[model samples]
Target: MTLKSVIFDVDGTLADTEKEGHLWAFNRAFQLWNLPFRWGVPLYRELLNISGGKERLAYYLAQHPEYHPLSNDEIREIYRLKTNLFMERVRAGVVALRPGVRSLIGQCYQEGIPVGIATTTNYDNVETLLLRHFGVQWKHMFPVVVAGDEVPIKKPDPAVYVRCLEQLGVSASEAIAVEDSAVGLKAATGARISTIVTMNTWTYHHTFLGALAILTSLGTTQTPAYGTGPDGWGRYRVTVDQLRAWLV
Candidate 1:
Protein backbone atom coordinates (compact mmCIF):
# COMPACT_ATOMS: atom_id res chain seq x y z
CA MET A 1 0.00 0.00 0.00
CA THR A 2 1.22 3.50 -0.83
CA LEU A 3 -0.54 5.19 2.11
CA LYS A 4 -2.47 7.56 -0.12
CA SER A 5 -4.38 9.18 2.75
CA VAL A 6 -4.58 9.50 6.53
CA ILE A 7 -8.05 9.45 8.10
CA PHE A 8 -8.32 10.77 11.65
CA ASP A 9 -10.98 10.36 14.31
CA VAL A 10 -11.84 13.69 15.91
CA ASP A 11 -12.73 13.28 19.56
CA GLY A 12 -9.77 11.74 21.33
CA THR A 13 -7.35 11.18 18.45
CA LEU A 14 -7.00 14.80 17.45
CA ALA A 15 -7.70 16.21 20.91
CA ASP A 16 -8.72 14.89 24.32
CA THR A 17 -12.32 16.07 24.07
CA GLU A 18 -14.20 13.51 26.13
CA LYS A 19 -13.66 14.61 29.72
CA GLU A 20 -13.59 18.36 29.46
CA GLY A 21 -15.24 18.91 26.10
CA HIS A 22 -18.19 16.57 25.54
CA LEU A 23 -18.69 15.36 29.08
CA TRP A 24 -18.68 18.83 30.53
CA ALA A 25 -20.99 20.07 27.83
CA PHE A 26 -23.39 17.18 28.42
CA ASN A 27 -23.39 17.84 32.14
CA ARG A 28 -23.89 21.53 31.60
CA ALA A 29 -26.81 20.92 29.27
CA PHE A 30 -28.33 18.52 31.76
CA GLN A 31 -28.03 21.11 34.48
CA LEU A 32 -29.72 23.74 32.34
CA TRP A 33 -32.52 21.32 31.51
CA ASN A 34 -32.87 20.56 35.22
CA LEU A 35 -32.38 16.88 34.45
CA PRO A 36 -32.23 14.72 37.52
CA PHE A 37 -28.75 13.38 36.86
CA ARG A 38 -25.34 14.27 35.49
CA TRP A 39 -22.82 12.05 33.76
CA GLY A 40 -19.79 11.80 36.00
CA VAL A 41 -16.41 10.70 34.66
CA PRO A 42 -16.79 7.02 35.51
CA LEU A 43 -20.34 6.71 34.17
CA TYR A 44 -19.47 8.79 31.13
CA ARG A 45 -16.60 6.47 30.38
CA GLU A 46 -18.98 3.52 30.28
CA LEU A 47 -21.51 5.50 28.25
CA LEU A 48 -18.78 6.20 25.73
CA ASN A 49 -19.00 2.57 24.74
CA ILE A 50 -22.13 3.73 22.92
CA SER A 51 -21.22 5.56 19.72
CA GLY A 52 -22.99 8.83 18.93
CA GLY A 53 -23.92 11.41 21.58
CA LYS A 54 -27.65 11.15 20.93
CA GLU A 55 -27.43 7.39 20.91
CA ARG A 56 -25.41 7.42 24.07
CA LEU A 57 -27.99 9.56 25.82
CA ALA A 58 -30.78 7.34 24.59
CA TYR A 59 -28.94 4.28 25.78
CA TYR A 60 -28.35 5.78 29.20
CA LEU A 61 -32.00 6.73 29.53
CA ALA A 62 -33.12 3.32 28.35
CA GLN A 63 -30.82 1.70 30.89
CA HIS A 64 -32.28 3.74 33.71
CA PRO A 65 -36.01 4.22 33.21
CA GLU A 66 -36.44 5.66 36.68
CA TYR A 67 -35.33 9.04 35.38
CA HIS A 68 -37.88 11.38 33.84
CA PRO A 69 -39.11 9.75 30.66
CA LEU A 70 -38.24 12.24 28.02
CA SER A 71 -39.62 11.65 24.55
CA ASN A 72 -37.28 11.35 21.54
CA ASP A 73 -37.85 15.03 20.88
CA GLU A 74 -36.76 15.96 24.37
CA ILE A 75 -33.62 13.84 24.05
CA ARG A 76 -32.78 15.54 20.77
CA GLU A 77 -33.34 18.91 22.36
CA ILE A 78 -30.96 18.11 25.19
CA TYR A 79 -28.33 16.89 22.71
CA ARG A 80 -28.76 20.03 20.66
CA LEU A 81 -28.03 22.11 23.73
CA LYS A 82 -25.09 19.94 24.57
CA THR A 83 -23.73 20.32 21.04
CA ASN A 84 -23.93 24.07 21.29
CA LEU A 85 -22.14 24.02 24.61
CA PHE A 86 -19.43 21.80 23.12
CA MET A 87 -18.89 24.25 20.30
CA GLU A 88 -18.70 27.08 22.79
CA ARG A 89 -16.06 25.18 24.73
CA VAL A 90 -14.08 24.70 21.54
CA ARG A 91 -14.30 28.37 20.66
CA ALA A 92 -13.18 29.18 24.22
CA GLY A 93 -9.99 27.19 23.53
CA VAL A 94 -10.56 24.54 26.17
CA VAL A 95 -9.19 21.77 23.93
CA ALA A 96 -5.92 21.39 22.05
CA LEU A 97 -4.54 19.11 19.41
CA ARG A 98 -2.80 16.14 20.92
CA PRO A 99 1.00 15.89 20.93
CA GLY A 100 2.47 15.64 17.42
CA VAL A 101 -1.00 16.11 15.84
CA ARG A 102 -0.34 19.46 14.23
CA SER A 103 3.13 18.38 13.17
CA LEU A 104 1.83 15.22 11.54
CA ILE A 105 -1.14 16.90 9.87
CA GLY A 106 1.09 19.71 8.61
CA GLN A 107 3.46 17.15 7.19
CA CYS A 108 0.62 15.47 5.32
CA TYR A 109 -0.62 18.78 3.93
CA GLN A 110 2.83 19.86 2.84
CA GLU A 111 3.57 16.46 1.35
CA GLY A 112 0.27 16.48 -0.61
CA ILE A 113 -1.00 13.37 1.11
CA PRO A 114 -4.73 13.83 1.65
CA VAL A 115 -5.90 13.93 5.27
CA GLY A 116 -9.49 13.41 6.31
CA ILE A 117 -11.64 13.05 9.43
CA ALA A 118 -14.09 10.25 10.21
CA THR A 119 -15.89 11.01 13.42
CA THR A 120 -19.11 10.08 15.20
CA THR A 121 -19.39 13.67 16.41
CA ASN A 122 -21.58 16.26 14.75
CA TYR A 123 -20.28 18.52 11.99
CA ASP A 124 -20.54 21.62 14.14
CA ASN A 125 -18.18 20.21 16.72
CA VAL A 126 -15.75 19.25 14.00
CA GLU A 127 -15.89 22.65 12.34
CA THR A 128 -15.57 24.53 15.62
CA LEU A 129 -12.58 22.55 16.85
CA LEU A 130 -10.69 22.57 13.56
CA LEU A 131 -11.56 26.16 12.81
CA ARG A 132 -10.27 27.29 16.19
CA HIS A 133 -7.01 25.42 15.73
CA PHE A 134 -6.40 25.50 11.96
CA GLY A 135 -8.12 28.83 11.33
CA VAL A 136 -10.74 29.51 8.66
CA GLN A 137 -8.92 27.47 6.03
CA TRP A 138 -9.23 24.33 8.08
CA LYS A 139 -11.66 22.87 5.54
CA HIS A 140 -8.95 23.11 2.92
CA MET A 141 -6.57 21.30 5.25
CA PHE A 142 -9.08 18.52 5.93
CA PRO A 143 -11.23 18.21 2.86
CA VAL A 144 -13.02 14.98 3.67
CA VAL A 145 -14.94 15.28 6.92
CA VAL A 146 -17.61 12.61 7.53
CA ALA A 147 -19.56 13.37 10.67
CA GLY A 148 -21.97 11.08 12.53
CA ASP A 149 -25.17 12.65 11.21
CA GLU A 150 -23.92 12.41 7.64
CA VAL A 151 -23.73 8.66 7.75
CA PRO A 152 -26.44 6.07 8.36
CA ILE A 153 -24.68 4.72 11.44
CA LYS A 154 -21.72 5.35 13.69
CA LYS A 155 -18.50 3.60 14.65
CA PRO A 156 -18.25 -0.24 14.88
CA ASP A 157 -20.40 -0.14 11.71
CA PRO A 158 -17.73 1.42 9.41
CA ALA A 159 -20.22 3.75 7.71
CA VAL A 160 -18.31 6.91 8.59
CA TYR A 161 -14.95 5.46 7.56
CA VAL A 162 -16.42 4.14 4.33
CA ARG A 163 -17.85 7.54 3.55
CA CYS A 164 -14.58 9.26 4.36
CA LEU A 165 -12.58 6.90 2.16
CA GLU A 166 -15.06 7.47 -0.63
CA GLN A 167 -14.71 11.22 -0.38
CA LEU A 168 -10.92 11.03 -0.12
CA GLY A 169 -10.91 8.90 -3.29
CA VAL A 170 -8.79 6.22 -1.69
CA SER A 171 -9.17 2.53 -1.11
CA ALA A 172 -8.95 1.03 2.35
CA SER A 173 -5.55 -0.49 1.57
CA GLU A 174 -4.16 2.86 0.55
CA ALA A 175 -5.19 4.76 3.65
CA ILE A 176 -4.55 4.63 7.39
CA ALA A 177 -6.99 5.59 10.14
CA VAL A 178 -5.88 7.15 13.40
CA GLU A 179 -8.35 6.43 16.20
CA ASP A 180 -8.49 6.44 20.02
CA SER A 181 -10.71 3.58 21.10
CA ALA A 182 -11.77 0.03 20.24
CA VAL A 183 -15.01 1.23 18.65
CA GLY A 184 -13.10 3.44 16.26
CA LEU A 185 -10.50 0.78 15.61
CA LYS A 186 -13.24 -1.63 14.59
CA ALA A 187 -14.82 0.96 12.35
CA ALA A 188 -11.56 1.64 10.52
CA THR A 189 -10.35 -1.93 10.31
CA GLY A 190 -13.84 -3.06 9.39
CA ALA A 191 -13.40 -0.99 6.27
CA ARG A 192 -10.14 -2.87 5.63
CA ILE A 193 -8.07 0.20 6.49
CA SER A 194 -4.98 -0.14 8.62
CA THR A 195 -5.30 1.80 11.86
CA ILE A 196 -3.19 3.45 14.58
CA VAL A 197 -4.56 3.61 18.10
CA THR A 198 -3.82 6.59 20.33
CA MET A 199 -5.07 6.04 23.85
CA ASN A 200 -6.47 8.80 26.05
CA THR A 201 -7.62 9.00 29.68
CA TRP A 202 -11.11 7.66 28.92
CA THR A 203 -10.04 4.92 26.52
CA TYR A 204 -6.71 3.77 27.90
CA HIS A 205 -8.07 0.42 28.94
CA HIS A 206 -9.55 -0.49 25.55
CA THR A 207 -8.13 -3.56 23.83
CA PHE A 208 -7.12 -2.46 20.38
CA LEU A 209 -6.78 -5.86 18.84
CA GLY A 210 -6.38 -4.87 15.17
CA ALA A 211 -4.45 -1.62 15.34
CA LEU A 212 -1.12 -1.41 13.56
CA ALA A 213 0.25 0.81 16.33
CA ILE A 214 -0.86 1.55 19.89
CA LEU A 215 0.59 4.62 21.61
CA THR A 216 -0.11 6.94 24.53
CA SER A 217 0.08 9.98 22.29
CA LEU A 218 1.44 10.87 18.88
CA GLY A 219 4.54 12.13 20.74
CA THR A 220 6.42 15.40 20.60
CA THR A 221 10.10 16.24 20.78
CA GLN A 222 9.56 17.12 24.43
CA THR A 223 6.95 14.44 25.24
CA PRO A 224 7.84 11.24 23.44
CA ALA A 225 5.12 8.65 22.87
CA TYR A 226 5.27 5.22 24.51
CA GLY A 227 3.84 2.09 22.89
CA THR A 228 4.54 -0.94 20.70
CA GLY A 229 4.22 -0.94 16.95
CA PRO A 230 5.37 -2.84 13.85
CA ASP A 231 8.58 -0.78 13.53
CA GLY A 232 10.92 1.68 15.19
CA TRP A 233 9.76 4.62 13.08
CA GLY A 234 7.51 5.64 15.98
CA ARG A 235 10.42 5.56 18.44
CA TYR A 236 10.39 9.31 19.09
CA ARG A 237 7.32 10.53 17.27
CA VAL A 238 4.81 9.35 14.72
CA THR A 239 5.92 11.28 11.70
CA VAL A 240 4.56 11.05 8.17
CA ASP A 241 7.83 9.60 6.98
CA GLN A 242 7.65 7.04 9.79
CA LEU A 243 4.13 6.05 8.73
CA ARG A 244 5.21 5.77 5.13
CA ALA A 245 8.21 3.64 6.01
CA TRP A 246 6.18 1.42 8.27
CA LEU A 247 3.45 0.93 5.70
CA VAL A 248 6.04 -0.23 3.23
Candidate 2:
Protein backbone atom coordinates (compact mmCIF):
# COMPACT_ATOMS: atom_id res chain seq x y z
CA MET A 1 0.00 0.00 0.00
CA THR A 2 1.08 3.54 -0.74
CA LEU A 3 0.92 4.65 2.84
CA LYS A 4 -0.82 7.91 3.61
CA SER A 5 0.71 8.34 7.05
CA VAL A 6 2.97 6.65 9.58
CA ILE A 7 2.27 6.75 13.32
CA PHE A 8 5.00 5.98 15.82
CA ASP A 9 5.36 5.14 19.48
CA VAL A 10 7.70 7.39 21.46
CA ASP A 11 10.00 5.79 24.02
CA GLY A 12 11.41 2.72 22.37
CA THR A 13 10.24 3.28 18.82
CA LEU A 14 11.06 6.85 17.81
CA ALA A 15 13.74 7.29 20.46
CA ASP A 16 16.06 5.72 22.99
CA THR A 17 15.04 8.13 25.75
CA GLU A 18 13.97 5.42 28.12
CA LYS A 19 17.13 3.76 29.35
CA GLU A 20 19.23 6.66 30.57
CA GLY A 21 16.96 9.71 30.54
CA HIS A 22 13.80 8.21 32.01
CA LEU A 23 15.66 6.08 34.52
CA TRP A 24 17.78 8.96 35.70
CA ALA A 25 14.82 11.25 36.19
CA PHE A 26 12.96 8.71 38.32
CA ASN A 27 16.05 8.02 40.37
CA ARG A 28 16.62 11.71 40.91
CA ALA A 29 13.12 12.09 42.26
CA PHE A 30 13.59 9.12 44.56
CA GLN A 31 16.72 10.63 46.02
CA LEU A 32 15.21 14.09 46.44
CA TRP A 33 12.31 12.60 48.37
CA ASN A 34 14.66 10.38 50.37
CA LEU A 35 12.59 7.38 49.28
CA PRO A 36 14.28 4.09 50.03
CA PHE A 37 13.32 2.81 46.63
CA ARG A 38 15.10 2.49 43.34
CA TRP A 39 14.61 0.64 40.09
CA GLY A 40 17.01 -1.63 38.27
CA VAL A 41 16.99 -1.56 34.48
CA PRO A 42 15.09 -4.83 34.43
CA LEU A 43 12.42 -3.54 36.79
CA TYR A 44 12.24 -0.30 34.89
CA ARG A 45 11.75 -2.14 31.61
CA GLU A 46 9.03 -4.26 33.15
CA LEU A 47 7.36 -1.19 34.62
CA LEU A 48 7.35 0.38 31.16
CA ASN A 49 4.72 -2.14 30.22
CA ILE A 50 2.55 -0.06 32.50
CA SER A 51 1.35 3.14 30.79
CA GLY A 52 2.08 6.37 32.58
CA GLY A 53 4.84 7.34 35.01
CA LYS A 54 2.36 7.69 37.83
CA GLU A 55 0.80 4.43 36.78
CA ARG A 56 4.20 2.77 36.71
CA LEU A 57 4.91 3.93 40.22
CA ALA A 58 1.50 2.75 41.26
CA TYR A 59 2.25 -0.62 39.75
CA TYR A 60 5.53 -0.81 41.60
CA LEU A 61 3.78 0.07 44.82
CA ALA A 62 1.29 -2.66 44.10
CA GLN A 63 4.06 -5.10 43.27
CA HIS A 64 5.98 -4.45 46.45
CA PRO A 65 4.06 -2.36 48.97
CA GLU A 66 6.92 -2.61 51.40
CA TYR A 67 9.11 -0.47 49.11
CA HIS A 68 7.84 3.09 48.72
CA PRO A 69 5.49 3.63 51.70
CA LEU A 70 3.94 6.34 49.54
CA SER A 71 0.22 6.38 48.97
CA ASN A 72 -1.40 6.97 45.56
CA ASP A 73 -1.48 10.71 46.18
CA GLU A 74 2.11 10.64 47.32
CA ILE A 75 3.12 8.66 44.26
CA ARG A 76 1.46 11.25 42.05
CA GLU A 77 3.45 13.95 43.78
CA ILE A 78 6.63 11.98 43.24
CA TYR A 79 5.79 11.52 39.58
CA ARG A 80 5.42 15.27 39.27
CA LEU A 81 8.87 15.60 40.78
CA LYS A 82 10.25 13.03 38.38
CA THR A 83 8.62 14.79 35.44
CA ASN A 84 10.21 18.03 36.48
CA LEU A 85 13.57 16.33 36.76
CA PHE A 86 13.01 14.72 33.36
CA MET A 87 12.27 18.10 31.81
CA GLU A 88 15.43 19.47 33.38
CA ARG A 89 17.41 16.62 31.91
CA VAL A 90 15.76 17.25 28.59
CA ARG A 91 16.75 20.89 28.81
CA ALA A 92 20.30 19.74 29.45
CA GLY A 93 20.09 17.93 26.09
CA VAL A 94 20.56 14.48 27.53
CA VAL A 95 17.41 12.97 26.06
CA ALA A 96 17.04 12.56 22.28
CA LEU A 97 15.34 10.90 19.35
CA ARG A 98 16.74 7.58 18.20
CA PRO A 99 18.87 6.52 15.21
CA GLY A 100 17.28 7.06 11.81
CA VAL A 101 14.23 8.70 13.45
CA ARG A 102 14.96 12.29 12.51
CA SER A 103 16.08 11.26 9.04
CA LEU A 104 13.08 9.03 8.54
CA ILE A 105 10.76 11.82 9.72
CA GLY A 106 12.32 14.19 7.22
CA GLN A 107 11.97 11.57 4.52
CA CYS A 108 8.29 11.12 5.33
CA TYR A 109 7.77 14.86 5.05
CA GLN A 110 9.58 14.99 1.73
CA GLU A 111 7.51 12.09 0.48
CA GLY A 112 4.36 14.05 1.47
CA ILE A 113 3.26 11.33 3.84
CA PRO A 114 1.76 12.57 7.09
CA VAL A 115 3.58 11.50 10.21
CA GLY A 116 2.29 11.21 13.77
CA ILE A 117 3.31 10.28 17.28
CA ALA A 118 0.95 8.10 19.31
CA THR A 119 2.47 7.43 22.67
CA THR A 120 1.66 6.57 26.24
CA THR A 121 4.31 9.07 27.29
CA ASN A 122 3.43 12.57 28.44
CA TYR A 123 2.44 15.16 25.84
CA ASP A 124 4.74 17.78 27.30
CA ASN A 125 7.61 15.35 27.10
CA VAL A 126 6.90 14.78 23.42
CA GLU A 127 6.45 18.50 22.88
CA THR A 128 9.66 19.23 24.73
CA LEU A 129 11.62 16.92 22.48
CA LEU A 130 10.01 18.20 19.31
CA LEU A 131 10.44 21.81 20.29
CA ARG A 132 14.05 21.36 21.35
CA HIS A 133 14.99 19.25 18.36
CA PHE A 134 12.94 20.75 15.52
CA GLY A 135 12.87 24.33 16.85
CA VAL A 136 10.32 27.17 16.58
CA GLN A 137 8.13 25.82 13.80
CA TRP A 138 8.23 22.20 14.89
CA LYS A 139 4.45 22.16 15.36
CA HIS A 140 3.98 22.66 11.65
CA MET A 141 6.24 19.75 10.83
CA PHE A 142 3.87 17.28 12.44
CA PRO A 143 0.52 17.95 14.05
CA VAL A 144 -0.75 14.70 15.44
CA VAL A 145 0.63 13.74 18.83
CA VAL A 146 -1.64 11.34 20.75
CA ALA A 147 -0.46 10.95 24.29
CA GLY A 148 -1.26 8.33 26.95
CA ASP A 149 -3.02 10.38 29.59
CA GLU A 150 -5.05 12.15 26.91
CA VAL A 151 -7.41 9.23 26.61
CA PRO A 152 -9.26 6.97 28.99
CA ILE A 153 -7.22 3.95 28.07
CA LYS A 154 -3.58 3.63 27.06
CA LYS A 155 -1.78 1.18 24.74
CA PRO A 156 -3.08 -2.36 24.20
CA ASP A 157 -6.47 -0.62 24.12
CA PRO A 158 -6.38 1.32 20.77
CA ALA A 159 -8.08 4.49 22.03
CA VAL A 160 -5.09 6.60 21.12
CA TYR A 161 -4.83 5.12 17.64
CA VAL A 162 -8.51 5.81 17.01
CA ARG A 163 -8.03 9.36 18.25
CA CYS A 164 -4.88 9.83 16.18
CA LEU A 165 -6.69 8.75 13.01
CA GLU A 166 -9.41 11.27 13.72
CA GLN A 167 -6.91 14.04 14.29
CA LEU A 168 -4.94 13.11 11.16
CA GLY A 169 -8.20 12.76 9.19
CA VAL A 170 -7.05 9.44 7.81
CA SER A 171 -8.65 6.04 7.82
CA ALA A 172 -7.08 3.04 9.47
CA SER A 173 -6.37 1.61 6.02
CA GLU A 174 -4.66 4.76 4.86
CA ALA A 175 -1.80 4.65 7.31
CA ILE A 176 0.63 2.30 9.05
CA ALA A 177 1.85 2.12 12.64
CA VAL A 178 5.50 1.50 13.53
CA GLU A 179 6.24 0.24 17.01
CA ASP A 180 8.95 -1.46 19.09
CA SER A 181 7.27 -3.51 21.78
CA ALA A 182 4.80 -6.38 21.93
CA VAL A 183 2.49 -4.23 24.07
CA GLY A 184 2.71 -1.54 21.42
CA LEU A 185 1.89 -4.04 18.69
CA LYS A 186 -1.18 -5.11 20.62
CA ALA A 187 -2.34 -1.51 20.82
CA ALA A 188 -1.90 -0.96 17.09
CA THR A 189 -3.52 -4.27 16.28
CA GLY A 190 -6.44 -3.46 18.53
CA ALA A 191 -6.93 -0.33 16.47
CA ARG A 192 -7.15 -2.60 13.43
CA ILE A 193 -4.36 -0.78 11.66
CA SER A 194 -1.55 -2.61 9.93
CA THR A 195 1.63 -2.44 11.96
CA ILE A 196 5.35 -2.75 11.34
CA VAL A 197 7.36 -4.08 14.24
CA THR A 198 10.85 -2.70 14.73
CA MET A 199 12.83 -4.81 17.14
CA ASN A 200 13.84 -2.85 20.23
CA THR A 201 16.38 -3.97 22.86
CA TRP A 202 13.98 -6.18 24.78
CA THR A 203 11.00 -6.78 22.48
CA TYR A 204 12.67 -8.71 19.67
CA HIS A 205 12.37 -12.02 21.46
CA HIS A 206 8.62 -11.73 22.10
CA THR A 207 6.02 -12.88 19.56
CA PHE A 208 4.90 -10.38 16.94
CA LEU A 209 2.05 -12.33 15.43
CA GLY A 210 0.09 -9.49 13.88
CA ALA A 211 2.90 -7.37 12.51
CA LEU A 212 2.85 -6.67 8.78
CA ALA A 213 6.62 -6.78 8.74
CA ILE A 214 9.45 -6.95 11.24
CA LEU A 215 12.64 -5.06 10.48
CA THR A 216 15.95 -4.30 12.10
CA SER A 217 15.36 -0.72 11.13
CA LEU A 218 13.05 1.00 8.67
CA GLY A 219 15.85 0.51 6.19
CA THR A 220 15.22 0.44 2.44
CA THR A 221 12.90 -1.55 0.26
CA GLN A 222 12.33 -5.00 1.70
CA THR A 223 9.42 -7.31 1.07
CA PRO A 224 7.98 -7.91 4.50
CA ALA A 225 5.45 -10.51 5.52
CA TYR A 226 2.13 -10.63 7.35
CA GLY A 227 1.42 -12.69 10.49
CA THR A 228 5.04 -13.24 11.52
CA GLY A 229 5.68 -15.60 14.39
CA PRO A 230 7.60 -16.29 17.60
CA ASP A 231 10.23 -17.92 15.50
CA GLY A 232 11.06 -16.56 12.01
CA TRP A 233 8.17 -18.54 10.59
CA GLY A 234 6.48 -15.90 8.46
CA ARG A 235 9.16 -13.30 9.10
CA TYR A 236 12.57 -12.45 7.69
CA ARG A 237 15.03 -9.75 8.58
CA VAL A 238 14.70 -6.88 6.11
CA THR A 239 17.11 -4.62 4.26
CA VAL A 240 16.46 -1.48 2.19
CA ASP A 241 16.57 -3.56 -0.98
CA GLN A 242 14.38 -6.26 0.47
CA LEU A 243 11.79 -3.70 1.62
CA ARG A 244 11.37 -2.41 -1.94
CA ALA A 245 10.92 -5.88 -3.32
CA TRP A 246 8.47 -6.81 -0.56
CA LEU A 247 6.32 -3.71 -0.82
CA VAL A 248 4.41 -5.28 -3.69
Q: Any idea what lDDT model 1 has?
A: 0.91
Root-mean-square deviation of candidate 1: 1.2
Q: Which residue pairs in candidate 2 have backbone atoms (N, alpha carbon, C) closer than 3 angstroms, thus clashing?
A: 220-240, 221-240, 221-242, 221-243, 221-244, 222-242, 222-243, 222-244, 223-242, 223-246
lDDT of model 2 at position 150: 91
Once fitted onto the true fold, the runs of candidate 1 whose alpha carbons sit more than 4 angstroms away are 232-234
Candidate 2 C-alpha lDDT tens digits along 102-164: 766776677667788899988888888788777876676677998988999888889999999
Question: Per-residue alpha-carbon lDDT of model 1 for 1-248, expressed as tens digits?
Answer: 58799999999999978888999999999999999998899999899999999899999999998997889999999999999999988999998889999999999999999899999999989999999999988988998999999988889999999999999999988898899999999999999999999999989999999789999988989999999888644456989988887785
TM-score, every prediction: 0.97, 0.86
lDDT at position 197, candidate 1: 92
